[model samples]
Target chain A: MRHYTAEQIAELPSKYRAHFINSCTGFKSANLLGSISEDGITNVAIFSSVTHLGSNPPLLGFILRPTTVDRNTYENLKKTGVFTVNHVNQNFIKEAHKTSAKYDGTVSEFDKTLLNEEYLDDFKAPYVQQSRIKLGCTFENEYFIKENDCHFIIGRIQHIYVDREIQAEDGWLNLERAQTVCIDGLDGYALPQILNRFTYAQPDQPVNSIKDLGS
Target chain B: MRHYTAEQIAELPSKYRAHFINSCTGFKSANLLGSISEDGITNVAIFSSVTHLGSNPPLLGFILRPTTVDRNTYENLKKTGVFTVNHVNQNFIKEAHKTSAKYDGTVSEFDKTLLNEEYLDDFKAPYVQQSRIKLGCTFENEYFIKENDCHFIIGRIQHIYVDREIQAEDGWLNLERAQTVCIDGLDGYALPQILNRFTYAQPDQPVNSIKDLGS
Candidate 1:
C-alpha cells in the first residue's frame, strides 16, 4: 500500500483538498439563509457541512467557514434567531450550488437562482419553495472551534415540510424517488439507487436472521 | 398542497419517523459495540447516523437513540471511551443491520456477523477489517438533547483505514467505485451513482459551473 505524509496531503491543490474530496461523498447539500437586513433578506449560502444534531427537539446543525468579508448569514441568524434549511434535489442542485458564491451584501441568491421562495407563517426567513424538503429552524446556539475557522450553528427545528409520497412505512424516506442528489468532491452530484433492505440483528448469533428484525 | 399538524406528524408510526427517513439516505451504516462485562461484549446495535465530523483532527460522530434500555453500545462506549465505527457496504448491509439487535450482555455481535475484526495500533477497539472505510475513534464529547432521546457522540478519529484505490487526487474518496451503501429509513440501502459535475459560481450568473470556479 502506498502512503503519503500529512504534509504531502496538505500540499495538494486547493481543488484536491482532502476536506473537499472526503466531504463530497457523504453530506447532503443544503441552503442556509436568514433575514438580517432592513429588507429582511440579505444572506444566503449553500452548505454541505450539515447533519442531524438530534431528533427530540428536532434539531439540526451546519458548520460555516468563518469569513471576514461579511457575516450576513451568521449575523442575521444571531440577530433574528431564525433561519431556514432547504434541501437540494436533482431539479435544484445546480441552482442550489450557486448559492455558495460570494455575492455582494445586498444581492440575494434567490434572485439569481431559479429557486422560488416561500415564507411560512410566523417565521421571518423564507424557505426554498422548490425544495422537496424544507425546515423552519430557530437559532439554538453557536460554538466556534478554537483552532478551526469554522462555526457550528445549531438550530431547533420548528416546522418541517416533506413531499407526502416520499414517506415510507417505517419513517424511511425514499430519496431515490425524491431524486435527492448527494455531493462528492468539490463539484459532483450523485443519484442514488436502492440496492437492498433487511432487519437489524446481532452479527454473532448462530441463527441470526435479518428477516426476523424489522426490515 | 397537503398539510399535517405537528401532532399528526408525530403520531406517525415508528416506521415513519421524519428525520430517521430523511437522514438515513445516502449515508454509510455502522455497528457501534461496547463491552459491559470484563470477558464479553454487550449492547450490540446498528446505526446509520454516523458522519465524518472533521478531518484536521479526524473527527467522526453518530447519533444514538435515547431510549433507556441499558444500551450496551452506549454503555460500552461510555465506560471504555472507545468504540469502532464499522462501515456497512452492500455485502454487509444485512449483517450490519443485525448488529442493532438488543442482545444479552454476554452476546458478541461481532461473533454473530460475517465481519472480521482488525485492531489498530493506536486504539484498543477492533474495527471491521472488511469495511472499505473504517475508523478507530477515541471518545471526545457527547451531547444529550434534553428534549430528545438522541445522544450525539463525537469522537476524535484516531485512525482511518480506506482501500487505496478509492483514494483519488488529494484524498477524494471514490465511494461510488467502492460500492458503499447509503441508508434510507430503517431497512433501505442506496447505491450511489455519479450524475453531474460543475464549478462553483454565484447564483446570479447566467452560467455557473463548479468546474469553472478555480479556473
Candidate 2:
C-alpha cells in the first residue's frame, strides 16, 4: 500500500498532483456540455463534473472552474441561458475528449473535432449528434465555493432524449447498454459492465438482486 | 429514441422518476462514507454523489440529502468534523449497497454489513479495510442548494492510502486496475474497464494515447 499525508501530497509536482488527486476520488461521470454563443457559434467541451442534484424538479449541477481565463461554455450558457448535456459514449470518446483542447473563442470545437452538432426541438444550444442520451437544460443557479474559486452551476432539465433500448421497464437507464463512458482522472475513459442491480434495501433481509425478481 | 419534456418527467411516479433522472446523468462515482459518533459508534453509508471538487488543495464534495430523517453519517461527521471516503469495488458491491439499508441510529452499518473497520493513524473516523483506495478528510465547507433541500458538503483531503498496484508512473490511479465500481442509479453497480488514457490535448494535434508515448 502507498500512503501520502497532507504535507507529502502538497509537495508533489503540480501536474502529478493533479492527476493523482483527480483519479484518487474515483470514476467521474463523463459528458460533453454543448452551448452556443449569441452569434450562433457552437461550443462543445468535455466535463466530468456533471452530477445529478435532485429528481423532483429534475435538477443537475456541475462544478465550473473559476472563470480566470476565457471559458466559452460558461460564457455561452450564461448568455444564452440554455445548454445541452450529452453523454460521451464508447464510440466517440476520442472526438469527445478533443473538445477539451483550448480553441480560439470564435473557433467552434464542433468544426475542429469530428463531433457533429444537431439542434434539437429548436433548443438554442447544440447537442452532440452521436450521444445516445441527451438533455436540454436551462440555467438554474450557481453557488460560489469560498474555499476554492469555483462555481457550482445548477441547471434544470427541460427536455430529455434517450435511446429506447437502454431504458428498463422500471425507468432505470442501463448505462452499460447505452455504452456511456466514465472518466478516470482527466483523460482515461472506461466502459462499465453492469454487475448487478439490487432491490430496495431493507434492514432485516439480505440484499436481493433486481434480476432475481424477474425484472 | 424516447422523448420526455419537463412536464412529462414531472408527471411520472416518484420512484420511477427518481430512477429515470438518476441514471440519466451518466455513471456516478460510488463510495462508502465512514464517520464515527462521539460516543464511539461508527457509521458507514454508500454515497454515489461523491464528486471531485478540485485538485490543487485536493478537495472533494458530495450531496447530502435533507436531514429531515435520521442521517447518522451527516450528524456524526458534523460533530466529529472528520470522515473517511472509501471507494466501492467489484468484490463488495453487495455488502456496499447494503449500507443503504435504513438501520436504526444505534446500529452501525459497519457491524451490520460484512465490511470491517480499521482505524488509521489516530484518525477519528474508521476506514474500510476492504477498500483499495481510502481518503481521510476534514469537513471544509458546505453550500445549501436552495433549489433542492440538499447540501453540497466539501471536504479537504488530509490523508490518502491506496493499493500500490493501481498507480501509474505519472501519478494517475488506474481505477479500472483497482476494480472500483461506478453507480448507474441508486442500486445498480458496474465495474469499469479502462478503454484508453489520452495525453494532454492540443487544438492542432489529433488525440494520442499515453500508451503511444511508451509511458
DockQ of 1: 0.36
The residue-by-residue lDDT of candidate 2 on B115-153, one tens digit each, is: 999999999999999999999999998898999889999
Error of 2 at A164 (Å): 0.7
Write one digit per residue (lDDT tens) for candidate 2, span A1-215.
78899999999999989989999889999999999999989899999999999999999999987463238998998899999999999998999888888887799999998899998889999999999999999999989898888999999999999988888878899999889999999889999999999988788688888872113
Clashing pairs in 2: none
Candidate 2: lDDT of A73? 90
lDDT of 1 by residue, A1-215 (tens): 23333354456565565444354225344344545455666565666556665544456666666573236777778777888776677787777667767776687777877777787766788777787766777788766644344666777767767777765555665677767766665556677777766554433443332321122
Question: What lDDT does candidate 1 reach at residue A185?
Answer: 54
TM-score of candidate 2 against the unseen true structure: 0.97
lDDT against the true structure, per candidate, is: 0.60, 0.90
Docking class of 1: acceptable
Model 2's DockQ score: 0.88
By lDDT, who's the top model here? 2
